[model samples]
Target chain A: MPEERRLRIPGLKDRIPAACDFVMHAARSAGLDERAVHHCQLAVDEAVTNIIEHGYRGDGLNQSIEIICRAERDRFVIVVVDDGPPFDPLWQSDPDPLASMEDREPGGWGIYFIKKVMDEVVYTDEAGRNSLMMVKHVQDAPRLENLRDHVALKVSVSNPVDDIWLFAPHGRLDARLCPGLDRLMTDKLEAGKCLLVLDLGDVEYVSSMGLKTMVSLWQRARECQGNLVLAAVQTRVHEVLQIIGLDLVFQIFPTPNEAAAALDNPPA
Target chain B: MLDINVSAREQVTLIEVRGRVDSANADQLGEALTREIESGHTQIVLDLAGVEYMSSAGLREIVSALKRAKRGPEAGDVRIAQPSYRVREVLEMAGLDTVLQIFPTQMEAVGSY
Candidate 1:
């Protein structure tokens, strides 16, 4: 993993590529694959471009851009700062990339792309400067090796009833937390503990990768003739599930206790 | 950046792309396919199995190609062949899977044209 660094440079369009170059070096040094590198590059480029083009009105020659980056074992975090006007990039309506080309005007598409490519993006303006912080979790297996060390995922196991083990993972189940969740849950299933319920009540957000982890774990549990189910899904979380069409795949329960009880009854 | 390798199979020309196709590199791909269309090679298949990750920007280029390909008198068409799992996810997520002609292999794609 590369050490975190901060760079202050002029916010110019030509300087956007240089910012991407700096991001690529950090991503590559952190052992991110080319795919991840491209994600990091495009995201940073867009952020910088927006700050220069929209925020500073293309004449950011005097204004300075502050870039802070961190390439950890499992995730890359970048924060771009511009001493420009206070404008919320995320406030724009997201363009549906699926919209027909004739109907697709270039309105807020870059912001949409940045939001889609990165795992998390937050914008804040303070002290007369605009700041955009973005995070992207590495997807390769190599990053998985040290994932637990980098991101702390609290997985608490409780045998609430006989023949059933309930695993409650606390915090965001985004890309940084999936590897740890996968290792912990899969280890238990492989150890012959078949019936398990993953309590996502504490999980803030579940990325597409997180859903993939849950699906794979479900597949593994089913392969061994055991059961794995989701418990106490939050409304936002369930909405995400519906978006990816995973709601049709999993058996959802209202509470962990209900889920445990349904271990015998099973949800219809 | 996108790595594109264009190959010929009878009247159909296959463009094998091997890299990430995002906003940064999608225009290059559009230009590559546009050149193919300009050269009267309308029957085209884009092999996306080598593409590891594709964002909506990549989907935009494919849509651009599809729109341009439809305009010609030959009524040439563009098809997708052997898209990777991630690529297919993006295609389906963006509702382009049904719009684009997808085949399991380049042979199938070439045969369709």
Candidate 2:
């Protein structure tokens, strides 16, 4: 049997949370990591919100929105259907991100974010019903046991310096494993070991939750007059950070030892 | 779910938002920001540390507040402090980071006023 779930809700802004919860449950059950789950949630949220605010307008109390979620082996697909007018959110011109405050408008971001987060977004109008199909590729987390072994043995056993801590995490840094890493880093911070280096040499992929964990730890480190740096980030993971300009915020080095050394010697 | 807390200090009025900000409650947020602006409290520091999620609706309110705060005789600005990771990403994606100044701590955001 194909893995699928369906929900029908009133085309109202108040029903957005229900729609999001229904999709999220399916996404999580499909083994999508936290980042993909968030993407799914946001995509659905924007879609439903758009339908209520624009498609149904204030008359949504009488209208209904139907949502369908399908979990394929390689991808998760969401389809939103409504009886509203024929309007394609994808057809709207993207708002200029570089526009000055005077020229900027607040209307286009909902659709823009939907496009950016989803791998594919397709809008279709049949008869009088409108349907939007969004797809997100499911990135499987790497073998957790192997990664656990690598992190357990390396971070806990080796210490080139007492003050600067080094953590070499292997495999994908997705939602499944970020909580573990977050706890470990949080413990270090609580113990007053603030200066830290994350060796991303073996990390193959990063999820939104993983990025959040890193940023949270970095901020915490800075709050205590310490810093967190990245080292040997793989090209794929590095590209993710670079896209969002996080590379400028966190000092990245070629190797963990170098990252540790930099942390040891503060620049005036 | 949304919670808005407003506290007035000597330099800036701090609005701390927690929970999700979507179309459902964005108007409430806009109203809260507008209430402060109408009271001539344009020097605002938005503390987003507790915010779990925010969409374009929330961004709209913040941008509107920033625009409103900059106008009039006592022109001031709205600053952000300690945005959650997701909130920060949304701001960057919307290109609001360039227009609205962001600080690492609430103290710094207030001090900038």
Candidate 3:
């Protein structure tokens, strides 16, 4: 059975947070991971902010906006309705993401982000109400197929200790690089070196594919009576782990040395 | 909720922002950046290590600040450091990552200016 939730707020600027929180809570309850929840929250925030600012024309004290979230088996949907004049945010053209600083303009980014993060977006006007619908899958469908075939993940392995090995991977750990990391880690686990530390000091990003790779490595290591730990996680990657609830599942350390020490000590 | 802290260095001014940056308090961020720019502190390094989430409204403020900082004769720049994953994703989606110089560390961002 699909679950549905609804929230209505005055078109005031202060109420945007409430609307966003309601959507986030609903997204989480629908079994969407933290990254998906964040994306939903962003879409809602953008839609509501646009309603209050552009739709209401800065006078939203009396207007009201309605937000509805529906969780299906495979996807989650957010619908926002505003009792304002006819304004379709998607009508605006997308701004160039690669434009130079001098050529950059900020006005069109809100709509651009909405389109980028959400799997689908639709806008409608009926009975004097404007509605914007955004949808995101629970397990986001893969967009880049065979990406690993072209790009290579630069990984360096260091046997810092007799029993522990540290693997440092550079660049983004997305679909293109996760396969390589997975293969490398799998090889190490098969070789009886199960106690592993992933040094993410140079890793700039981690996609859903990367998280899946890490989980797989962790599970494989545990099956062999060994463990995998993360080390030197950058601030952004750390936050991603926390958002996806992996912070609790993974033993994260500040440095490779500390991670090696933990591997030796082992929480008993 | 949002918390912004500003400290002026000899060559660059560092602004540390924490918490959620949304429509409700985006004006505060805009004002802070404006304050620095008005005071002739064009060389700015924004540290987003603590930012939990940021909306398009917050990104707008950043772009506005970047434009204002680079407008006049002094021609200062705004660089970013240590943006959280969510914030970085949004910035990248908005194409601000291409327009602005982003460093991995605060020291690097400040040093770039």
Candidate 4:
């Protein structure tokens, strides 16, 4: 495989959607799963938005944001380069997310979300330009199981149950955490268990890239004679879902457990 | 670049956020707002209408100004006017619209201040 694709767009908000589409297409052509493709898309958005807003100061006429997507054996690397003033996005240390919204400041959450979503984040400010590199591992291959401690937000599979959980993750489902969700959903769907429940209790936002992943996963689940269900969706996520009209396609629930139970005995 | 224009009605600070607002320039806008606040200006308006986009860094500047106005000794008030649609979307997404008062017209914002 050539293993890489590159694009350069003028620093403008209008170009952001095209830039994201280019990355999504590249990832799909590289044989990456839909979720992984979505992760790359959001990562590209966050990076390019930074470049357009901060790098060129929204001067679409002046500067440009460059994106490069490279596929590795196990991971995909997306590099965003800009020729704006020297600024390193990786060095930004986020203040405590747990702080109260009032006491807490408003900015810096974009980079924080980017760091949290990607597995590995690297930044460089060489030659008075900024380069942010994000990496996400591919989850198509069957892998060994490691007995890791279960974290609250970490996605994992329980026993071989028939229910499908379609977690319509809102917010920035960026490069950091998409792989985990992809792995969990794919593993369960591949096992032919159809009972699904998506916990969206915490998802308040989702990028277009994230939406694409959810659609692909829904298709995969349908192919297996199973269906995916969403639960406890916040208004913000629900709005986007409704905008795309996926809300009508997927079975929605009020809670994760409810969706899981309904999957066990779907209404005729 | 920091560009400040004052009138008898209000002090309008137009901080052109050129680059990403990460930690680097996060304080640049905040400092500009604070300087205006300290100079005995109670009624202030920020014209982010020129700002093509904003991130958490740029958002922090707005929040900082809001807090300063709220805590000022003389009941200082700050209003944001003419934020771009993208900026407005982000603010609504983050629920900052509920926290910060937004105005569509600079005249409305200035009048409020």
Candidate 5:
């Protein structure tokens, strides 16, 4: 099924939220998951904010944004079209997080987060406007038995018992829910088990509160002589880690299973 | 667009901003502040209670005003009061909250100065 929606709101910052709300409702009605809907909203926010801030330059020329949603059997596709400059947001260099706050830069994180959240992100300049297409897979609904009964985070521990693996998260870790994950990790660390594998497969977005939770967990694990390892990180999160040079600080694996296996056998 | 209402009491200049602060009308805010500052009013309190949303570009205007005030001969300070949560988040994200003195109430903001 294909449905198209368009909004022309003068390219002003105030209208961004309304635009985001419209996209979210459309995406949800298209049968996307809540997490996926949030991702789409964030992507739209970042892209449209860029257009309003950088593209229109406050010209008040009634800058326009168009959202197109197409639902397939297993995936939903959402496209954002803006009559902005010929800039490809995907090509922008990820900011260096290691740089001091004074030297650190603003922006660039939004696009990066969009890439991380959506399953696929593509950018193109068509007919003098920028188009960003984001795809999200609609997984079969979780089985009743597998559904989380409570609000607790369901952490999958992959590593063996002897070696230690750590999960280190960086970026905007909001205070509301991250502490729950941190507490779960700390509980495992206190058990004196060394091998730990962190499943960062689902974490692409975070805030300052989330960052603190990660650091706190890392310190707790270190105190127990257990090592921290990160796996399945999105490019933007990885860039932040690398900029801070934390890529050197934490052992990384491409997947949680790989991290778990590495914990099982020490490289000698 | 931003609607501004100015109220002058003693030496304090209170500017109330209504509606959204985006790229569309951020310049108007800067102009208003510049006109006030040019009119020899140094102590300024901006009431953002009416502002529902603000973006980074809108935030730049406020920052610009702060910079202009700092550089002005009068050495005036621009303070924001009663900012909405969304506006407050943008300010915090941009790290402007630390650079500008923000108060929760207009009376407190004006009384402090």
Candidate 6:
């Protein structure tokens, strides 16, 4: 049987998160993987947040939003209803996700995310209510987005020790360069390197997408009983890791040599 | 909406950002910081503990602040402190942690300046 959940909340900003969390958990329990679950959550979040912000304009304290998450054998369906002004996300022009920071402006992304993440999205206004319907299939077709993207990072692979591969990625390691890093790590792991060290001394920045990539790499390494170590993390980068508490997740060293040395001794 | 409260502590302008700093309110936060920089309040300590959710747009705002803070040779920097997990995750994601000063406490961030 298809599992389903429904939630109705004041279309307030604070309530939006709870709605998203509820949907995300429902999606996860419905057998959606992490990536699919996140996509669904983002789609629902963006869609509802729009209604609360632009549609109502009054903080949505008096308005109500309805969210329904239903999971079929091979798909997840999300439906959001609002009593605010008639607004349709499908009509908004697409924003370039890869736009340079100089050209990128804040906002206008709610609809864009809804379009990218959801397999299908339809909007309708009937009888003083706005409805947004979104669908997510289990197996999405392969995306060619990365193929057209231009990565900004310069990755140089070095093997300083046997059985351990060191990846030194330079430049901005944001979402744009994550695919490259993911590909590199996959190749290295598939080649049977048991230990890995990422030297970030030359890296100037690591975006949230970059952090996700690192976490994914660390998780993959652990699955094989191998390890991924972070070395030469600069002050700013180190602080970010500490702030995020990822410093505890991975064995961190002040220098690459130290990381390599620790790998030899092994971590408890 | 992002609620930004600015208070001065010696040489640092302490800006506390509350609420989510996503695409919706990111521009307002960026413009607020730009006003501060234009007013010569370069030394800054940003408290992010109240931020519930943050996205790349928020990171871009910080990057802009960093650039504004480093405009001159004698310019002060924008220090970050007490970031919530969501804020810190995006910070780590952008690798901005390598470029920005992040302290564990607001006092530490201000004291560093």
Error of 5 at B67 (Å): 0.4
lDDT of 6 by residue, A1-268 (tens): 6777889999776676688689889888877777667667767777777787788885678779999888877668888989987665544556565554445453465665565556556554545688777777665523413212323234545566667777777556787557757866887788877589998987878888989999999999888888899998888887888889999998988898889888877847
Candidate 6 stretches with Cα past 4 Å from truth are A100-102, A141-268, B1-113
For model 3, what is the C-alpha lDDT against the true structure?
Answer: 0.81
lDDT of 1 by residue, B10-103 (tens): 9999999997665546778889999999898998999998987665567767777888888888978899999986577556645566578899
Candidate 5 per-residue lDDT over residues B3-83, each given as its tens digit: 899999689999999986644466788899889888878689999999876644566566666666766687688999999
Per-residue lDDT tens digits of candidate 4, residues A1-268? 7478889888877677678788879878767765456546656777877777777886756777888988877777788888988776643555454454466665556665455445556564444667776766566312312101111122322322433444433334544456556665777678786556666776666677667767777788788887777778888889989998999888878877777777777779
In the range A42-156, model 5's lDDT, one tens digit per residue, is 6677777777667777663566777776776665667777887776665465543244334434334555545544555555445566777766656632211211121212222
Docking class of 2: incorrect
Model 3, residue A80: what's the lDDT? 92
Q: Give Cα-based local distance difference scores for all models.
A: 0.75, 0.80, 0.81, 0.64, 0.65, 0.73
Better model by TM-score: candidate 3 vs candidate 5: 3
Give the CAPRI class of candidate 6.
Answer: incorrect
Candidate 3 deviation (Cα RMSD): 19.6
* Residues B1-113 of candidate 6: C-alpha lDDT, one tens digit per residue: 78999999987899999986655567888988898888888888889988867655577688778776777456668889999654564455444566778888988888887
Compare the candidates by DockQ and give the number of the best one.
Answer: 3
The 10-residue segment with the lowest total lDDT in model 1 chain A: A141-150
lDDT of 1: 0.75
RMSD of 6: 19.2
Q: What is the C-alpha RMSD of each candidate to the true structure, in Å?
A: 14.2, 19.3, 19.6, 15.3, 13.7, 19.2
Per residue, candidate 1 scores C-alpha lDDT tens digits across A10-106 of 9676566577778889878877777667767867877876777678787888988989988876777788888887776654655564666456542
Which regions in candidate 4 have their CA more than 4 angstroms from the true location? A1-3, A6-67, A70-101, A106-108, A111-268, B1-24
Candidates sorted by DockQ, best first? 3, 2, 4, 5, 1, 6
